[model samples]
Target: MTTLEKKGSDGGGSSSQEAAARRGPAGPGRFMGGQGTEKSKDFKGSGKRMLGLLKRERPLLIGVLSLGTFSVAASVAGPKLLGDATNLIVEGSLGKAFAGYSSKAEAVAAQHGKGKGKVADLLSSVDFVPGHGMDYSAIGTVLLWVLVVYLVALVFGVFQGRLAALAINRAVFRLRQDVEAKLSRLPLSYFDKQPRGEVLSRVTNDIDNIGQSMQQTLGQVVNSLLTIVGVLAMMFWISPLLALIALASVPVSVVVAAKMGKRAQPQFIAQWKTTGKLNAHIEEMYTGHALVKVFGRQKEAAEIFRQENEALYASSFKAQFISGIIQPAMMLVGNINYVLVAVVGGLRVASGALSIGDVQAFIQYSRQFSQPLSQVASMANLVQSGVASAERVFELLDAPEQTADPVTPERPDELHGRVAFEDVSFRYDPEKPLIDGLSLKVEPGHTVAIVGPTGAGKTTMVNLLMRFYEVSGGRITLDGVDISAMTREELRSGIGMVLQDTWLFGGTIADNIAYGADGATREQVIEAARAAHVDRFVRTLPDGYDTVLDDEGTGVSAGEKQLITIARAFLAQPSILVLDEATSSVDTRTEVLIQRAMARLRSGRTSFVIAHRLSTIRDADVILVMENGSIVEQGNHDELIAAQGAYHRLYQAQFAQAVAEVD
Candidate 1:
């Protein structure tokens, strides 16, 4: 049984003295470790960790890799083709000029000699002129080359587009799955300090940003790196001096990018933190909109949101604006180098130290080098954001929790439902023990009630018993064997709980009730609903149990929702039952109905009821009145009343409140 179960049992109420004994010097009991202390540090290993995450689905990763390579090849080849075609035009034009000169010389010699007659005949025809005025044949040849260039470019464009789409989509899917799994595996304490909005930002906004980064940057980074290397090789091959001039800006540009990246990475981290806070505030305001309106604090809420928004804006502006400076700075340096290379290369070509095509090719390579530098600067921003999100995500996955069950879980043939908490002592924080060195033995087929004040560690007790948190000191046993020795699934499968905060998925009522159970029969479901008094309400719905519900049961009444929860719990029909403030949130009439449903649920199973209403558990087999974190009194209702102790005082106070309400 969990700490929640131990404290919720209304029958096993403890006395004030026992509760005092359990309380720490500061206050009531609380987890084995104190609340708000579980820090997640999962993102520590960058290279190995990322690789491990990918190893599970090697085929999918390999496909992404292959497509990514294809995309890079296409992008680089497409640009190279454009430059190559320009050179072909230069070469083809030069060929036509020489051919025309030779043809003219032949025609002059023929006109002056015996072939003069044939030359005159050719000149008269004019249509037979192969190379004349401005080389029409060369123009025709260049037009054909243009058509081929366009056709090749179109093919590469299509290939690049398809490959990019396929590679990015696969990477995003895999990344999302890994993130989801990490979130699921994290301990519940991860949620204690953070706002729902912040958590949502990590899962939704942060992950989406990472996905977008991966999609755009992955190919660009790889292709740009390759392009830079290729261009440098070509430049050196053309003329070492011109190549040296063209790359004069390389070291300076690299130094600038490195310095900018160093400043930008920290700012990106700050920006994301600000984003999380802003998201948390927005989420809180939306969820509590009703309360804000009732209190007429809309302006106040808006002001709070404005503060968070301003912080987010400031952080983002600084980070992005600074990173944005990198591209233009790189362009300026490239432009200066471009002028230097052009002047040097032009002089060399004029002096016959270099060919015209060589100088032109060197100029092209210089421009090409600038492209990769520009790309690196741009993609650097995305990489920073991805790294930040990766860190936060890893933190979540690294949080500590109870040890996982062994490779092979110990599954019992049957559960006898005998529960015992011996010498149990626990604290949410080590400084404040919620349950002092306490012990209890619950025999099979008995109802146990735990009564306590608000901070008396009722829920904590259930948490411990359920092994949601490991015990700080003490042992819990089920049917004479230690529960710690059993697998979590095996231990929890035999227990059913209906908590006050009921949750329903976006599915038909029948589906939610059946949940993880395999193929629940219609009769069995309806029977369980009837037992829990939810069948009558289900019948009233237009779709009965088939009615689909939105998350949180937006369409259903609160009472009906509670009834459905009860029905679902009853359907499980575990060996032990736990009711955690089940009726506290309902109206008086619904409470009575639910109390009756609880009675039916308690018929055969060993039940733990955590109740606030004294009248409801008057017939409990055992009542343990708890205060702070200890049981101060334990006895039947009549016996505790006769003892004139804490339980008696609580009963009297409730009776007086009932009388006052009636008047």
Candidate 2:
């Protein structure tokens, strides 16, 4: 019996003091979530952690950066080269302007005599030849260089992209692997408090978001920032005054990004939170779809889904809308800077303080500087959304892990299933005592039956026995060795459990039956099925043992599913068997068949039978009636009835009507 049985929760959890251990629906603020308006408490901290995840890929990252640098360097040189070509054309045209002169210097000297004019000063820098037109050959040379430089940048860019992709994917792959390992390390109690869908969202949706965020932003942000720096250097080299004017927009762009990012971050967090919540609701409703239909809750479920969807849509829209403003806002600032630089450059050209070609290059540099800024702003949303997901993933990674397995674990030499609980005490809540100082022993090859009402700690005892939850005090031993000292694998390997809820994965009938025992042979599977009375029903199918079942085993009846699980247990052939109301789902005839099969399977093996129905376990060697986490009556059924205590009263109440009808 698991913790859910003790709480009687059909959903993830229920309201019970002891149920808190597993995590009730109304649990502490951590798992159940607080008011659903929560955001990442630490943004920069999570961002650092997200970046830190790429530590192992530092080499690949360095290679990517190296290629990107080369790429940017090549791209930056193109505008300057084009400017040089422009200078050639302007100088050649000036040579054509004074075509009748004997030399270009004579023409310039004729125009300005012995003193210098503004045009003459500008012409001093130009290499003008008499009768020369536009320098088509030189322009062609510069164009070829431009083409060569751009091609080089393109090659480097492709390689940079490949390397960056490899790095990001590898980091995400490792993160996925870490989360997978972490799930095994987490205690069952951790899951008890959290919805399955919420956890699933963290593993699938959140992690995927982290990968996408990094993929879309990491290299792009680096490239954009570097482009700004490279372009700034060239801008200042061309003309400091225009460069200053272009840079004036930086503060405004930064302000817009910072403010909008701050506002949008909470919305992204809310969006993901609502996503997890909605997934949980969908999963719950889908799992219990039959129940919803039976109860006619389709309209209510649809309405609830609509509300959550609306919440998700609102949060998403706000996040996107806020972040969306960044690009146009940045473009506005960039355009203003472009106009200022152009006007300033035109005046510089008019005064002959700078050549037209230099002013043209300066204008290009100004545009280059602002373009990357717009790109960075545009990708801000991906970065923010990714960081939000990173924060969530980090939460799962930071969740307190289960107690470590013993370094030097003990294992029983032989499998004699003598189990004992010695002065064992437990509590889901420290203040609320449960099963205090309770002690019980079961001999080898004997069956111990635990009968109790809901929340009576019958299931809790089994949970403790299975070491699902550690005992608050004392110890539990199997075959004279403390069970806690043994590794969980070793402890559980000796025991076989058939839970009330039959789980049959998507596989053939033979595979589901052979699931528990590794390397189970076909004969072994068939033999186990025969022993569990599953062979009779299975043989009637068209495909026989090869018949495939869906995840929920839809084609099979409830009795058939239970029988299949029983067959799985039989295949395991464990020394200790636990049957937790295994026959409850079957019909009277099927239940009788199961009891007979279980009796045979229990021979020479220590078995613990937990039954809610009283009549089934009347023949057990020992009967313990539990209430409020302690044994209130103990004996065989006949002896307990003679005592007329709790067990006798429960039996009478359950069977009195049947007894009257039969009499």
Work out the TM-score per prediction. 0.82, 0.94
Per-residue CA lDDT of model 1 for 1-663, tens digit only, reads: 221111232222333333334432211222122222112233235424543544555565455455444544444343344444454455444445435535544544555476565434333222223333344565566556646655654564455545655655665678777667776665444454456777888878777776676667755675577668767777787789988887778889989999887777777777787677678767777877888899988887777666656666766787798888899989899899989998998777655466555676677678888888888987778877776776665555556644777775555556777889999987655665667787888888888888877778777677677776678788988888788888887888788887766767789988777763457798888887787677877888899989999876878887777777777887777788877877765778877877787787788788888778888888778888888778889988889999999999998888999899999
Residues 284-388 of candidate 2 have per-residue lDDT tens digits of: 899999999998889878877777777888889989999999999999998988888888887787666887788888888888899999999989899889999
Q: lDDT of all predictions, in order shown?
A: 0.69, 0.85
Q: How many backbone overlaps does candidate 2 show? A: 1
Cα misplacement distance, residue 69 of candidate 1 (Å): 7.7
Instruction: Give the lDDT of residue 286 in candidate 1.
Output: 84
Residue 407 CA displacement from its true place in model 2, Å: 1.0
Q: What 10-residue stretch in candidate 2 is worst by lDDT?
A: 2-11
Best TM-score among the predictions, by candidate number: 2
The window of 10 residues in a row where model 1 has the poorest summed lDDT is 30-39
